[model samples]
Target: MAFKVAIFDWDGTLVDSVEHIAESLHQAATELGFPALERNAYRNIIGLGMVEALDMLYPGLSREQMTSIREGYARYFFAKATMPQNVFAGMADVLADLRTGGRGCAVATGKSRRGLEKALLTSELGQHFDLTRCADETRSKPDPAMLAEIVAFYGIEPHEAVMIGDTVYDMDMAQRLGMPAIGVEWGVHDREALGQFSPRAVVGSVKDLRFALGI
Candidate 1:
């Protein structure tokens, strides 16, 4: 409740796009002649940048293969209609309330610039954020660099901002900066996986998340 800035993750934290993302990745993998794994495999890599995620999924891939995956994934992702309804229930209201209360709201996401732009356009919730940093623009998650950039933009200290995300990457990024993080359970990881990072809290639902934010 003492936080001045609220930074959120895009995919599972803000939107219910987990299944859609996993399916798209699988489609892209199949298109590239790569062996498509289970949805959970894709889920584990959800919060990472595309290239980073692919590397984790299929290590030692050729650069050409990486490019193909990227293009193919983007194509498949956009082919599925992502509408404003994809946003998690009450998430839009939370963002609006944060902005209305003069709290800085930002996004530190693994989504590419183009991907985030497309999502923002479709969702129409982009205006709620004061700033957004895409993985393509900075170091990806599990690294604290992008979060550092976000806090620096608002001229606030790390402790003044709270990161709300669903993955260990988010928790790890916040921990590296000695910042507070609230892990949402509905995303990639379960409560047990998220607790290993010693987050401020691990919430199970939107109501719980709101209480953590005091919004």
Candidate 2:
């Protein structure tokens, strides 16, 4: 059956923002007198919301410390707004094509509602999506809540939607909801790593992703 809705992950999947993410995370740690994490350490938690990501990175921190670090990270991240955070090549056209083909596009991201809104505005890609859900508004990835909500909102069955993301969280979430998933390689995770979740296809480029989605 043709996919009626296409749910996407925002950060590493659609936009190239890992460097900025890592920089902000490192800054947050250092500003709090904590040891700075390596770039890969930050990348490993790219698909989680800020709170969850901080929790994993600095386990055992007090709630107050977590709050402070989260604030600092947001400050550092948005301060670098001038830095270029570009969409993957061909994604704009592909999104338009999908819409033209009668497929509704939506975002299911680990970003906070405010962060995702800013991204959508800055990227000018907000018009492409029919619906969006953030980690703060729903359970984070691998929970299936976000996708389940999107499917329900569209009045479509689980199999009528496809999840496209770069992490195992995305694939596992979709699988749990009985939806098909496609993995893109250009994100934080590698193909081999994402493959462990058994995505329908692990695509290396946006071009390949278009083919996988048949858009």
Candidate No. with top lDDT: 1
Mind giving the per-residue lDDT tens digits that candidate 1 earns over 1-215? 79999999999999989998999899988987999797899999998988899999999999999999888888889886668889988899999988888898999999999989889878988889889999999998998999999999999999999999999999999999999999999889999999999999999988998899997
Q: Which ten residues in a row have the lowest lDDT in candidate 1?
A: 75-84
Report the lDDT tens digits of candidate 2 across residue range 130-178: 9999999999878999999999999999999999998888888889999
- Candidate 2 local Cα displacement, residue 45, angstroms: 0.4
Candidate 2 collision pairs: none
Q: What are the runs in model 1 whose C-alpha is more than 4 Å off?
A: none
